[model samples]
Target: MQPVEGSDKAEILKNAAAHVAKAASSGSKIIVLPEYFNSPFGSQYLPEYAETLLPSPPKQDEAPTFYALSTIAAENKVYLIGGSIPEFNPQTKKHYNTSLIFDPEGNLLAAYRKAHLFDVDIPGRVTYYESEYLDSGNKLGLVDLPDYGKIAVAICYDIRFPELATIATRKGAFALIYPSAFPIATGSIHWRLLAQARALDNQLYVVLCGPARDTRGTLVAWGHSLVVDPMAQVVVEAEEKETIVEWELDPNEIEGTRKSIPVSAQRRFDIYPDVSAGTIQFEDPKLEEP
Candidate 1:
């Protein structure tokens, strides 16, 4: 959705509230929004928009965005994965692209600071460096949804790193969800491929939510919000319009795929070190590419 002219915090949040309510009315138990849902997908404005949540002040007046998400989750009784937010880190004096999850009770469940900062120089195409302004997360995140079981989560660029999904799969995550904003340059080609690769390799379901296409700004987004099944097929997708595409996932598919391939059980750990834990050693291991 395009932000209204001179978008204020309240208006940005009200727009989100409307979407959440609509999803709930359609019987969606779990709702996911696109990355940078409330703010424009630009780096310069991050500091101005970043805010804190729950456990702290962010000031006496709570961060309006946080309050809005929590209220919506509780009132609607829907599990909400609030897309990415620019977060201010006081202790480190840095900022991060952060994703937050809220339970139906309006309680904070999980937080994943985007680890793989988007930095690519596709000369003649598009160039962006999230590392220039955003601090990277040092760890991976996994959250368990009561009736639904475990689900792994990462932001846009983080999806390109297979290690994140591998670790989550080992920890029993049957599905993965990413809130993303794929710029037109890369999204046109790589968006769906990455989603399909992650799901196929892990034998799990993969869901992605992205902002609908809007040509007003200098930057353009490839808008094809989608979900992939364990079978590695695009189950449902949305056009450039602002709409919700919902689908049900079956765990049996995951079991069946893994059982047929058996790649998860047949890993040759003796030949290569396990990456499932995704631990970081004191010195980063460096190797030349194959």
Candidate 2:
């Protein structure tokens, strides 16, 4: 979706619901939104737009976006991966960039705060620090969807870490979903590369959903939302505009890819330690019924 202007939170959500409805009408069982779907994507704006998303069904006044997402998912009867949002913890008085997942019944299944915050300083290029405003999420983002199996969820910068993807693969995730808002500088250079690398490394589907370009906004996002297959192939991609790209993923693809390469079966755990062997935190799929 396009970048939202100041005080347009309601409008942003309305458009998001419309998009989800359209996709669901076309037989999309699971839908994804971009990061910062209801607000602008910049560190400076985090505090201004952050909302409390706790206590299951958050008070409608305090967290309208949360309610809106639940309604959208339940009404459409589709699993919704709400893109990352600016979450404000009232008790701790800290902020987090978080993503919430809802089932077809509108139950809030999981919430994943971004584990890896984007903090980079390029001499003459891009310079930003998410740590300045937001706290890092410590837990892994894995949720099991009925019938379709499990999927790993992560924010933008988390995609750069292969261990998360690998762990998800070992834990039986068929796809890794990343809701991102990449600026033109680094995004133009590393967006697709990282997607392909993660998919190839784990032999799982990699899906990237990003906001469309907004020249009028403070930061211009590199809006090439794409899906990389298990073979590390870019099957479908969106340009730098507000559009939807939908494709059906086949489990056979994952099975066929692994059989052809057999890297997953041939991994030398004796030579190198398996990173996924250790204990990791995972979200319970039966969390917070509606």
Candidate 3:
């Protein structure tokens, strides 16, 4: 893993490509990078970092992270999840916290914008208000692969919501990947627990990739990146330092677990009164039309 420093787009892309090349040489078929591996954090510089949608080439002065990711995927003949990047939306003229996936052939397979923005006031001590900078995504993201089966993606804060994972599972995702930059305070308390709980509850593999420690000291993130199996067993975990973790996932286990528990088929939605409750309430009819 490359511990990216500063927001120099070219340098970060070069480092990431080198890491992916090294891993590919070592026989890794799939690689996942940490969240915002392409850009710097904080809401201040988001406008400058956002990338346009696919088929529309990124600006010449833009960082090479996205292009490098696609090239690496094609060159290494490996599946690459381009972690989370700041993406520009043509319609809204705003940026989004987004994740994109590429196939071995360099085809854009899937993309996801963070649905749950990280907006919280940490008891008057520290606060992270992501909603102020990012626009939330409305749809869940899933991609299908012949070898890995169906894989779902969720960004950092999305892990806190089980409904997102549930929706992914309902979409036939056998594995879930989370690219996060969880702060030290919350990560220390809930990171591993949330990953384990999501895996066990969904009976699917969960892979988490987190950024290395930040020296800024203000929003330092915990770096316990890990991969958990369907039974909530840890396959590989990274220490506090920069690291790369690789593991072979078995799809047969997903089939077996679902057959054994059959929880998906046994869901008692009929008995749940609030299952159909409207979550989005609008104050006016104009607000309801989009």
Candidate 4:
């Protein structure tokens, strides 16, 4: 979708819901939106756009986006990885770039705040600081998808870190989903490379849902939402436009790829400690709705 002005939060959500509905009607079981789907994609809009999502079942008045997402998921009978939103933590008095997951029943499954902040300066091309307005999250974005295997969630900058994807794969995630809004500078170079690297490294699927490129907007997102298969192949991709990308993922593809390569059973953990090892708590898969 094109970037909206700061005051167009309501319009943004409306457009997002319409797109989601269209995808669901087209037989999409799992849907994902792009980053900043309910607001503009810049630090200047974070203050007015931020909304509280904690205390689960947040008041509709407080977080209209939250309710809207939940309603759509339930109405469509699909799992929804709503793209990142500006979150205002009332207790800490800090803001965060957070992604929310909803089950088919409209229950809030998990909320993953962006762990890595995008603070970079390219000198001539681009310079922006996310830490100045948003705080990083400490937890990993791992969640189970009912009968299907587990899937991971991460925001734009989080995709740059391989550790997060590795950890999620080690914990049994079949696919990794990232809601990204990459600028033209980095997106043109590292966007596709990073997604392919993560999928090839883990022998799993990598799904990237990026906002549509908006030349008129201050922050022009490099829209090219894509999906990489377990074989590190670009199966389906969209151009730089407001397009709905729908693809079916097969669990057998992941299993077959791993069997052919056999990397999971041949890890050299004795040489270097596994990054996913240690005392860690993963979400209980049995807790998923049957």
Q: Ten residues in a row with the worst lDDT in model 2?
A: 281-290
Model 2 residue 172 CA deviation (Å) reads: 0.2
lDDT of 2 by residue, 1-290 (tens): 33333348888888898899999999999899989888886766777788876665577888888889999999999999999889886665678888889999998889888889888998877898878777888888898999699999999999999999999999999999999999999889999999999999999899999998887777788999999999999999999988888989899999999999999999999999999997888765532311
Candidate 1 ranges with C-alpha deviation above 4 Å: 1-6, 54-62, 91-93, 278-290
TM-score per prediction, in order, is 0.90, 0.95, 0.87, 0.93
Task: Rate residue 96 of model 1 by lDDT.
Answer: 78
Model 1 C-alpha lDDT per residue in residues 25-81, reported as the tens digit of each score: 888888888887777667777777888653442443646677688899999999888
- RMSD (Cα, Å) for all candidates, in order, is 5.6, 2.3, 5.1, 3.2
Using TM-score, give the best candidate's number. Answer: 2
Name the regions of candidate 3 deviating beyond 4 angstroms.
Answer: 54-63, 90-93, 273-290
TM-score of 2: 0.95
2 versus 4: better lDDT goes to: 2
lDDT of 3 by residue, 67-151 (tens): 6788999999999988888876667777778787888987767777788999888784458888776888876667787676778
What is the TM-score of candidate 3? 0.87
Supply candidate 2's per-residue lDDT for 95: 84
- List the candidates ranked by TM-score, beginning with the highest: 2, 4, 1, 3
In terms of TM-score, how similar is model 4 to the real structure?
0.93
- Report residue 228 deviation for candidate 3 (angstroms): 1.2
